[model samples]
Target: MPYRHYLLGEDQKSLLDRLVSQFTLAEESHGSLALVYLDTFDWRLHQADLRLVEEDLCGKARIDLRHVDGTLLASGDFPAKVFAWDFPPGSLRQALEPLIEMRALLPVARLGGRRDLYAVLDRREKTVARIEFLAPQVRGNEDNRQALPPRLLVHSLKGFAPEARRLADFLEGPCGLTRSETGLFDESLAALGRRPGDYSSKINHGLTPALPAGQALRQVLRQLFTTLLANQPGVETALDSEFLHDFRVAVRRTRTALAQLKNVLPAREVEAFRKEFAWLGSITSPARDLDVYLLDFPRFQGFLPPEARADLIPFRHFLQRHQRTEYQRLVKHLQSSRFRALVCRWRDFLEQPGGLEETADGMKPIDQVADRRIWKIYRRVLREGQAIGPQSPPAELHELRKTCKKFRYLMEFFQSLYPAEDIGRLIKALKGLQDNLGAYQDLHVQVETLGRFSREMVAEGDTPAETLLALGRLVEGLDRRQAEVREEFSERFARFAREENQRLCRTLFKSSSPEQA
Candidate 1:
């Protein structure tokens, strides 16, 4: 049985109410179509992972996406067939993401006598997929397909991509399947050349350091990445995006874990990953930025009317063209052999059991790996902060900020084994430090971008002077807007950071005995 399913709530209701007079997909054949049944709540969370959303949007859950699925499933239970796939969790997350985000775009067809929601065909009109709930009358017949009241999900797909796995993930990622949906998902998968426990071996780790708890949290970062990148809502193929997200996560986690377990893994490997990730993060920035810009651009435009928009449009065009070219370049960078080799090496590293070297004193290395290094990085950052003067170079300050973030995340990830309150305090202080530095850096980037754009727009005066003047005004407005935010930001930061040293001391050593947070 598929673990989840996605159905139209309105259609489910209509069908449950025996009111699905509008659903034509059930009676109709959708050539090469697929339908996956997903539990609305689980699917969205499972689809758009918390990390990506948090990093991209907010620290807290966004209500905008919350309950979106249940809301979609506004109606009650209906007899439905679900198509299930037996794919790796990673693969499954990747495939079904699109449907979660693009439900509004899905074309509805009816199944059986119901009409509200039934089948979906892909963008290209090659196939149609519909799901039908078992008839109540036939559901009691044990010998028939309706006997189990199989929750049904159905799908039609083109060549090459495994339809069952792709379809199953699509259905199950957010909305879980019903008892009946599960039955149908299983039945459908069997029909399409898959059975339970059928799938490729999962790559469980990619550049991770053993935690102080030893192997308990070995691949937390990888898991985070797998959940985020693999399940991004768009893109035709699931593997690429999933892998990308996982890879980014693996990098981040491994880096964090290394900081926490510096005593275990070779320091050089930790440094190497940190350096590589800096490049990887840059490559991914275009994609991530584009995503953010797409979300907020309309709002940004709306802040001013067409007059302001007309001024900013050229800058927008420049931004778009630059982003496009940069994206293409980023894709190429991802495809480069160097990148693949790094991934392969990372995979090889993760497969090995690392950390905890046994010594002559009969002491376990992992014991020290967690305790000693955790406080050590914390101490170093604090000392560095004290030692560095206002005359410190930006490079030094930037390094300091990176160290704080690393330790902050480390504390959070391993809070299960730490003095929670103190670590939380430290995290807050580090955040203040980062906020100040980050805002400064963002302003710098904006200013630099503006200068470049101005030159490009003003070249040879091909367009009217009004457009240039408007664009210049637009950039000035943005700068002014940013400057406004910068004001009072420092005072808040200073208040938060003044006692960072005391807070770190209290948090790191708060426990009287060895205990987990």
Candidate 2:
């Protein structure tokens, strides 16, 4: 049966006292357990309307996956685990693997709580409903704890619909209870000064069309700067590859924004920051490259034949060893004075007064500036994409890919200024083409990287001949896949350049100014 959760008021009387006056109640069970909620940095489980809690009682611990309504979906003994792969195969693992792909689960909140279960009885001494009181206290460092509002969970028993409905009415009317929309997990996050789904790499600055171009671009930069800082700790600690990935993306977006929205800021200031961001980008690339290979190791192994699969173990070890080295190097650079100064100065530039200098388009309305910039980039995309042919070099496709990325970024930054549905449709069409181009480029890089790594292993010695042979097969497989991706490029580009999409793009972005509407 479905249950309901309610948040009690601070000044409310004891629930047991309120209940005793209505009916005879019997204590069912009572216990105290420490609850630690888990989710990825981006709140993956919360996004899926699920909660995973690790309950520690005395010294023993168990993990539970539950719906927001408190229904148990799965439960198992808590093990020493970081990633989902660390769990022994079970329903819990099955549920988590897909949702948290390539991300590590981290404890988002912790609370020590006591739970008391009671049975509401009828005159005939029959149990008609169950009420559970959860008294949670937020657990913090140095044995400090903060108590939160107690929650009441009411469960309906079979053949007791009227009793449950009557009890709910009484509680709502006289007891002054209300439903809790966010439940314990989010409430705990609130107590800790955090919010679920607070971190995201996507750009949504809520820019207005009539806002000054300078002010609007500053808003976007501020958000991107926040994201860049938020992901820094995770990157330094090597929590997961996604930390570095998101951090790099924030940097790229900042650079792209400054470059595309030229004249909104002083040219010299923009150029200085771009150089600093470019340096940051360069330092982070080696680690990110190795992370990609490590993350793709399983798929790379699949490319080998069954008999040769074992040979790739050495290659995996090699990647891990180098991944560590790259991370150490990356972290050192991240902690260096140069990086620190850049961060401090960049923050000041984005946040301080008098930071933005006078420029040509600084005071222009954002909608006018956005329409002009997007239209120019759209023309570039069309020209570059149309110029590609079957005989064109991979470099040409690569240049077009970069152009497409800039066009997409501009649209996303100013997406609020356009009709959502129309803009979204155009982005979807462009994404298909981008995906094909991305895959083609990635395969080419992989083929080259494999050759480079193979030579390094040989130079370092102790590399078995069979491992090289297995790598050769992997490269051969990648070559075949790259050919396939390349073959589909024409069709993908055609779809993106179809008359329908072209017309939509023009309708949405081709105008020179809001007055043109």
Winning model by TM-score: 2
lDDT of 1 by residue, 300-404 (tens): 566565766655555566567665666567667767897777666665655553543431211233333444555666666666666555455556656766776
**Number of backbone-clashing residue pairs for each candidate, in the order shown:** 57, 0
lDDT of 1 at 68: 23
Candidate 1 lDDT score relative to the true structure = 0.45
- Model 1 regions lying over 4 Å from their true place: 1-250, 259-261, 267-278, 285-306, 353-368, 376-400, 419-436, 457-467, 498-501, 509-517
The TM-score of candidate 2 is 0.92
For model 2 the local lDDT of residue 484 reads 97
